[model samples]
Target: MPELPEVEAVCRKLRRDALGASIVQLRVERPSVTRPQDPAHLESETPGRRIESIERRGKNILIHLSAGHILHIHLRMTGNLYVIPDVRFRPSLARLWIELDGGRGLIFEDSRVLGKVHLHPAAHLARVLKDVGIEPLSSAFTLDNFTRAAKASSQPSKIFLMDQRRVAGLGNIYAAEALFRARVNPRQSARSISKPKLANLHTAIQDILHHAVSSADAAYAEPGHFAEGESFPCAVYDREGEPCTICGKPIRRIAQGGRSTYFCPRCQR
Candidate 1:
């Protein structure tokens, strides 16, 4: 799944290239994407509406439209969005395509078909995302706030971080990386962390996320070309059995909450 930084990269691309481009047409290549919800409402509400702006809320993209509607997109595992010249540019696994002005088209492709797209009234956008926790990149996510949130859970640190209702936009990749950076074990209970270590964890989380966004931008010529997972280098994520950057011990991958977590056993204690 695309985490915070990956989704931010997508949002930046959409805001730069697709904003102000009215949706000339809407095509749902996969009927399953429309779901039990009627596609007619999406077709009626999307077309002719200009994409005013794009914002990243947690791991989701909020497309603000001129028609007082917001197009919410959750690019779950193996899902990505692209802006290309032709609608038929890459027809392999496109789920939805937006025909925009200026002969450009935005395509949503998902190999697993787990991504979701919904049209919501702009006024109710808050309700749609009300359950999401505080944005980690925001100033509001101070050590005090993090401590308070952590007290509400006793799960492993990695699992606690991955909970969107506790701290928004964290996934296995970043959570593992953040725990490694903080020198904290992934299996440690959230409430068991000390104040000093909690402070370090908070700083590590922000630093890692910000560095990822910047590194992703520098690595790709176009924001639309950036992808998460292996595309971004990690300190200890998905490098199982490889030597840790800080310590010579082999990086290990363990299962936590049904997700893989990579960390250095020696360094991340």
Candidate 2:
């Protein structure tokens, strides 16, 4: 799944390339990828509509269009969005293609087909995302708000961080990295964390996510990194058995909520 940083990266790219461009056409190769249970609505409503802006809420991307319509996309897992200035060759598993003015195109490709595309009125976007939690990068996600939410949960700290209803846009990678940075064990219960420790965790979350976005932006600013699909830099995520960057102890991986969480067991206690 594309986490907050990845989604935000894609959102920024869309805002730069796709905004103000009129939707020339829409194609859905796999019908199940779209919502409303009807693929025609996407094709019918999107044409000739100019893209106003693109934003990221939680892990979903919102393409705000003229006429008060919003196109929502969830890149669940193994899903990616690419902007092609000129279509030299279409990539494999390209599920949805949006033809734009000036011959530029946006392609949504997912090998697993777990992603979803939905079209709704801009007014209904709030309703559609009603269940999503606060944006972690927003000013509203204050330390008090974070502590209050943590105090109410007994789930493991990593699992708590992954809960969208608690704090939006956190996934296994960020959760583990944040926990390690705060020196808090991922297996610790959320409510068992001290206020000071929670404060550290809060700071770690914001700093790590912001740094991830910056790194992504830097990478994409380069000419060919986006089309080549380069992997984002990470501190400990997917680094199982690697030496901890801080303590030099081998990092560990554990199963939490059926997801693999990587952390420095020696450093994160």
Candidate 3:
């Protein structure tokens, strides 16, 4: 799944290429992408509406359009949006295509078909994303807020970080990396973590997310090129049995909430 940093990067790219362009056409090759809502409505309603701005909330991409409508996209896994010249469009691979006025196109492709698209009035956005929590990269994610949420949760530290209701946009990979950086064991109880370590965890989460976003932005070469997981640096995620970068101890992997978490047993206590 595309997390905060990846989604943010995609938003930036779209803002650069698609902002201010009016939608000339809405093509849904896979109507299942826009479920429950009639595809014909989007096909008709979206055209002629200019894209005002693009934003990212949690793992969703919001394309703010004229007439107060919003195009909400969730790239659950194996989904990517590509902005390319209309001449380069591939109908076979695109699940959805937004034809822009300037001979450009926005393509959403997902081989797994797990991604989703919804068209709704801007007023309904809150209901659409009511379950999402705070943006860790935003100013609202303060140390006090993080500490309060962490101290209140009895879940394990890794699970606490991964909870969308507490901190949005964190998944198994970033959660593991943040805990490893903070020297917090994945199995440690969130409520039992020391205050000082909680502070470390708070800073670590923001720092890692910020760095990941910047890294993704720099690595983004061109349109139609989505970032790969290996483009971002990882401290301990998926490095099980490998030597820890800092302490030279072999990293350990454990299953938490049915997801594998990697951490250095010696460095992260």
Candidate 4:
């Protein structure tokens, strides 16, 4: 469950480090790791084509190619991307590798078999992502729609946030963090939240995600201190019995929608 911030970090690395590169060769150990098109077709189309720009739609990383194709990476759980100049120094559990002109390459390393890579023409990208909801950071995610969607559901606020169909890119970690930031209990009814709190929740979601992305960028720019696979210090997530950052009370965990939510009862309620 690499959330929006994590995905954003990977895309930034791809843009800054992997762009302007040429693919000399490719190897796929796990075909399911990425959808297999004709390698011959990709070899002809990808090589000599520049990586024009990098963008993200929802949780998907779109690597825009000069050939009018987009190499999309959906890093599912336990999926990691490594950009290394030495094939010998590549990370473990590599599913695929795209060798560049030099020694550099984009390595798709994932222990879990959940990650997926897809190549699509530029003309079909919009259609491919048409079902995704407006990005939470975008201006299109108005408060009205946010509130209306939440109210329309009988699910808990925590559960509603995890619904990818209603809102894209929010996973367990972010949902818990944003709920703590908004001071909303995870078990509370979505429609029961007050208007002022709803607004606060919206702002909290945006602020937390923005801050996370900023920290991710800082980590990417300086990878020495950016320990790979490191997660940010969270207020509630993964801290089952830890002390609340805001209050002295202990953080609690409850199972909802078959997922565990960590929060401080005092702080969130």
Candidate 5:
């Protein structure tokens, strides 16, 4: 699954290329995608609407429409959106295509078939995404706020970070990066972190994520061309058995809350 940065990259591309485009064609090659809309209902609701803007909320993409509706997309694992010139362009294995004005199209291709698309009002969607926690990048999330949120959960530091209801958009990769940067063990209790260290953690999380976003932008020629930022984008996520970038110690891996967490055991904590 693409984390916050990857989703942000996708949103930037969608906004630049697909925004303000009319939905001239709504092609559903895979019946499973529109199953929620149902063929008849989906056809009635999708066409003729113009995309006004595209924005990211946590890991979801909100495609604003002029018709008082929004198309919400969650590119759950292996899903990506493509924009190309040819009208003949279809999903290489695309399950859905929304044709914009002219020959441009927003194609949703998912090899794993786990991605989802739904149409709803911006007002009504709060119910679906309300449980998601604060955007760490948002102005509202602060050091004090992070401490309060983390202290509320006595769970492992990794668990506290991974909980979307506690801190939004943190996946294992960035979680590992942030914890390693904090020099705190992933298994430490969230409540045990001191104010200064927690402050470091707050700074570390934002810094690491911001570094990744900038690195990703620099690493790709176009935002639409992001190849694989998630496979291993930083210090410890996939550096297991390799020398730690900071301390030269062998990186290690462990399973936490069903996700594999990578860290420099000797340096962390």
Candidate 6:
């Protein structure tokens, strides 16, 4: 799944290459990708409207169009957007292809077919994303705000961090990495964590996310890094039995909210 950093990187690429480009055509390879909104409607309405701006809200991509409509796309699990020359060959699993005016095309490819696409009026965007919580990178995610939310929740700290309604754009990978970086146990009760630990966790979340975005910016610039597989730097994520970066003890893997969480037992108490 593409989290905040990966999604933000994609948004930056779109803003650079796809912004201001008028849509010449929209081809929906799979109708199910645009559920609730008819593919016919998207094909008819999306063309002729220029991409005004691109923004990232949580893990969702919002492409504001010339008119009142907004192109909303969620790369749920395996989906990715690529801007290639119109003459370039399309991928086998390409779901939606938006032909641009400058011989370029934006392709949305999803191997698992779990992604979502919607074209809705700007007025309906708030309703569509009403469940998304505050952006952790924004001014709203302060230490006080984090502490209050943590104190109010009884869920484990890792689960609390992954809740979209509480902290948007955080997934299993980053949550585990953030918790490990903060030296906080993933299984610790949210409310039982001390104020100092909560403050550390808050800082760790922002720091890790910022660092990941920076790394992604560099990686996306390199050829084939985004399209091809690239390993992301992580201290304690999916490295079960690996030596802890800080302590020599082996990194432990535990299940929280049915998701695997990796942490150092000696370093993260």
Best-performing candidate as measured by lDDT? 6
Which is superior by lDDT, 1 or 2? 2
Which candidate wins on TM-score?
6
- Candidate 3 lDDT for residue 47: 95
Candidate 5 whole-model C-alpha lDDT, 0 to 1: 0.80
Which prediction has more favorable lDDT, 5 or 6? Answer: 6
lDDT of 4 by residue, 100-201 (tens): 768887888788878877778999998988877768999978999899888988789999888877778888998999999899988898889989889999
List of clashing residue pairs for candidate 6: none
Models sorted by lDDT, best on top: 6, 3, 2, 1, 4, 5
Q: After superposition, how far is residue 95 of candidate 5 from its true place, in Å?
A: 1.6
- lDDT by residue (tens digit), candidate 1, 10-42: 777667678788888888778777676577778
Q: What stretches of model 3 exceed 4 Å from their correct place?
A: none
Candidate 5 local lDDT, 1-269, one digit each (tens): 47777777777766777777888867777777755776555556878999898878777888888768888888877787768776576647878887778877778888888888777876887896888898989997888889898788899999899888988887878888899989889999999987888998899888877877665544433644647564345889877899999889999999998889898988888
Tell me how far the alpha carbon of residue 44 in candidate 5 is from the true structure, in angstroms, after superposition. 2.6
How big is the positional error of residue 116 in model 1, measured in Å on the Cα after superposition? 0.7
Misplaced by over 4 Å in model 6 are: 228-231
- What local distance difference test score does each model get? 0.84, 0.85, 0.86, 0.80, 0.80, 0.87
**Could you estimate the TM-score for every candidate?**
0.94, 0.93, 0.94, 0.89, 0.92, 0.95
lDDT per residue as tens, model 6, 1-269: 58888899889988887888999999899999998779999999998999999999999999999879999999987889868876257777789998899768899999888999999899999998999988999999988888888888999888998998888999888999888878888889889988888888899889989988887766776654465224568888878999998887999998877778899999988
> Candidate 6 lDDT (Cα, whole model)?
0.87
Q: On lDDT, who's better, 4 or 6?
A: 6
The true-structure Cα RMSD of candidate 4 reads 2.4
Each model's Cα RMSD: 1.7, 1.9, 1.6, 2.4, 2.1, 1.6
Q: How far off is model 2, as Cα RMSD?
A: 1.9
Which of the two, 3 or 6, has more TM-score?
6
Clashes of 5: 1
Candidate 1 stretches with Cα past 4 Å from truth are: 223-231
